[model samples]
Target: MKPLLSIWIMLLCGIAGRSFAQTKTSTDTVVKPPVQLKTVHIVQYNFFKDSLAFREEYAKSLTFRRLKWYEVYGGLSVNINNLYRVTQFKKNKKKITFKHMLLNKEQEMFVSRVYTPSLVNKVTHLDGDSLQLFMQHYQPDYAFIKNASDYDLYLAIKKEYEAFMKTRDSIPVQP
Candidate 1:
């Protein structure tokens, strides 16, 4: 009976010692706080600034490209044709091509206005080469930006940046 009591006491002491050691090790470990991304307050889109930029681009294109009189006439015709549908004018490939060029320019301007570098930087907190890379990789389409509100654009950028960071973190480093 004395031997059995001694063995039981020894077992209890061993278990207690292990639990005490575990508690000490746990207390020694430092807990790190989770990382939080920065937030941006977006302002409303400025139509006045957008119009001025469009005018500047138009003038630059006209001056540098030295577009012919016929081309200008064709572009104007296409605009008029849109208001009052003319089947014959629509069939004209040259006029259609000129109109397409103007539309492309306008789309490019719209995208730039909506997705400005400053806006992206504000949302993503990225700059220099990283900023440039993000902009290049996640450039929004004109259709998407055209309908998106400032807040929508901001959320889209934030989501993209999070995904970008996740992928970047997952990539293994090589020596």
Candidate 2:
């Protein structure tokens, strides 16, 4: 029984050590993703409800496809202040910060809401067009592109915007 218990303890510690070791980013070898990941940020005034609704729908829309999607929900222009600092979305954690400006005092108050997803799946239900639109448009005015053989992220953005605007009848697909 003592030998069996010792083996179990050793196995648990081995798992724990491996988990901690995996968090390090490897600089020597770089793994590039085949398809580019995209996100869009749109701003609006006097349409707080609409913006919130769109945020929720955006999340659902993103989940439509078999890829990871991200949506930000907030009131009016408030979310912009905090979400901007997020350089990258950490795996399963959703961090939300709320701030309110007080008219009487010269200080801003801060409140944060942190949620860990019960179950996180990087896949969802959006169509190809919508998915394309979501990734391409960083702002309503900004689009990002994935480079081809000459793959330039910026050029991809430019091409996608032009392609999105032109009519299919204007130019037919060339075989």
Q: State which candidate has the highest TM-score.
A: 1
Clashing residue pairs in all predictions, respectively, total 0, 12
Q: Scored by Cα lDDT, where does model 1 land? A: 0.74
- For candidate 1, lDDT tens digit of each residue in 1-175? 9999999999999999999887795568898898998999999878668767766776644333322334434543545533334334544455556656876877787788769899998998999877777787778899889898889999999999988887865544432
Expressed as tens digits, the lDDT of each residue in 28-132 for candidate 2 is 568877996697788653344644554475554333322222333354444553444443444223322111112111111100011001100112122455444
What's the lDDT for all of these models? Answer: 0.74, 0.38
TM-score of 1: 0.45
N/CA/C clash count, model 1: 0
Q: What is the lDDT of residue 20 in candidate 2?
A: 74
Model 2 regions more than 4 Å off: 26-175
